[model samples]
Target: MTGVTLAKAVKKYGDVQVIHDVDLSIRDGEFCVFVGPSGCGKSTLLRMIAGLEETSSGQIHIGDRDVTGLDAADRGVAMVFQSYALYPHMTVEENMGFGLKMNGHPKAAIKAKVDEASRILKLDDYLKRKPKALSGGQRQRVAIGRAIVRGPEVFLFDEPLSNLDAELRVDMRVEIARLHKEIGATMIYVTHDQVEAMTLADKIVVLRAGRVEQVGSPMDLYADPDNRFVAGFIGSPSMNFLKGQVAGGVIVVPALENRRVRTSVVLPKEGATVLVGIRPQHLTVEAGDSSLILELRERLGGVSYDYLRSSTGEKIIVETRGDEALPEGTAVTLDFDDTKAYFFDGQSEQRLR
Candidate 1:
């Protein structure tokens, strides 16, 4: 297995540029994920690395050799796409071996590789089954098995689990994680789901508008985000942002009943408004309070998410344990540890720290 490096990489079609000057490094045997919303150029960047799309300028190096000008087939990388793309008439065993056979490898060599991939993916029993007979998760495994048979230096996955159902998606996420541990290959995965990025990646590249926002380990990005976009994007339910105005190094928030938030982070000029971010996990509500109303409650088995709406229609969500239900119109007061809050510049939207 080998690493991948992109230096000053830029992609342009005519005069319209979708990918900007991006530089990234993926170490050997590392599982890196490119994550962002739709049209963020995550897929286009992956395609460029795979040699499926042309690089208008800059360089891409796989391990020690520069593969910028190489063809897709000559890049020593195998890709598993969103669709299975399996041959309907062929059996699982035949499909897994087809790539090697097309390259004119000996039948014996192809069979040996297929057997190994089957064992690794636990598809030894379904080798003779066709795509139509396999479950969605099984078909995805076969798609992955096809890539594993090639023994590429790097493996690229383009949202391979998006097509699966919720349960199947979870199951395949585990399977893909296990596959990486067993093979220890350099793998790059793309997905908009932060849950997948948090659970599967050793490193994550957060992108937006064709620009790389930040790159770091899952916990590093989660616990300490550089900007408002990353702090909101890395966590589930997201961090809440409340408007406030600075007064003598203190932030006064109207939503928290003019609560004073004192943080060590440098404050802007007095009376300058800023943003205070707090995760739902850190927020709690006091029943029988003024202003804030319990708008809705979602009972999700072990935990419940309570949605609160202020008199001004500002929304806040609180995650609490147990399945207790709160009345829709019940009055409440928002409470949180002031030290746990994050301060951001209102105009630039950057972290104040």
Candidate 2:
């Protein structure tokens, strides 16, 4: 149960560099997740920490040891990949114990470790089953069980639940969270799924194009993002952005029928362009002076979302918990507190405040 640290880590392939100087720290027994879009270098960074990819520059330390130059097997870290990669011919029990057996652990020790892992993963009933006979979730659990039997100091998961169906993904998410609590081991999970990152991570590292965008708890990143990219990426339904510019110490959004919205962030200059961001949940729809037309409505049991299009044609999503559904094609006003709004530089896409 130890932490991991990366100091100015860099990775390159011949002339091209994908992972920039990344400096990160994961606390002991913490569930840290690396999350971003495809080719964002999250997987590369995870591989670097697992010693699968060499660090072209900088250092990586697991616990107290500098493991930058260590081989995958010597780094005291176990990786569960996107694929289960199970041996087709072996039973669940055999697959789980294979790593330890290959390491020359005694038969008794291997069986004991495998049994413990199976118990943790709730795979005792399927121990005798081969890969082909088990469901997708079961196979994944077996893959995780294999990792657990090795008893590595840190566990690295690279999109381990991507292959599962929606229902199984949710089930496995709970299972993995439970596993973390039961084992209390430092874990680093990589995924492009923001929902998974938001639900599973104790801390999240948001990466973009070989760079660290932001790092914080899920809500922290959601409520307060450092840049436009992060503000838009971290939340479900995404934050709605309206084009605007500063005028008379307020931001003027043309999409809202030239309505002026006040912001606490200092304006760059009068008429300087900026982006106004508001979360869908923060928006309230009511009869008012604004000229927003409800274009569509999505009712999802306990909640509903109203999709609106402004006079300027900018689309907005408004989340509501009301039982009554708003009729589409109805003209309505969208209201939100100015303080709840986020301002970003139009050019840099950085948060103004």
lDDT of candidate 2 over 106-157, digit per residue (tens): 9999999998998999998999999999999999999999999999999999
Name the runs in model 2 displaced over 4 angstroms: 287-291
Candidate 1 lDDT tens digits, 183-292: 99999999999999999999999999999999999999999898899999999888888889998779999887888998999899999989999999999876866888
Number of the predicted model whose TM-score against the real structure is largest = 1
Quote the lDDT for 308 in model 1.
Answer: 86
**Model 1: how large is the Cα RMSD against the reference?**
1.0
lDDT of 2: 0.93
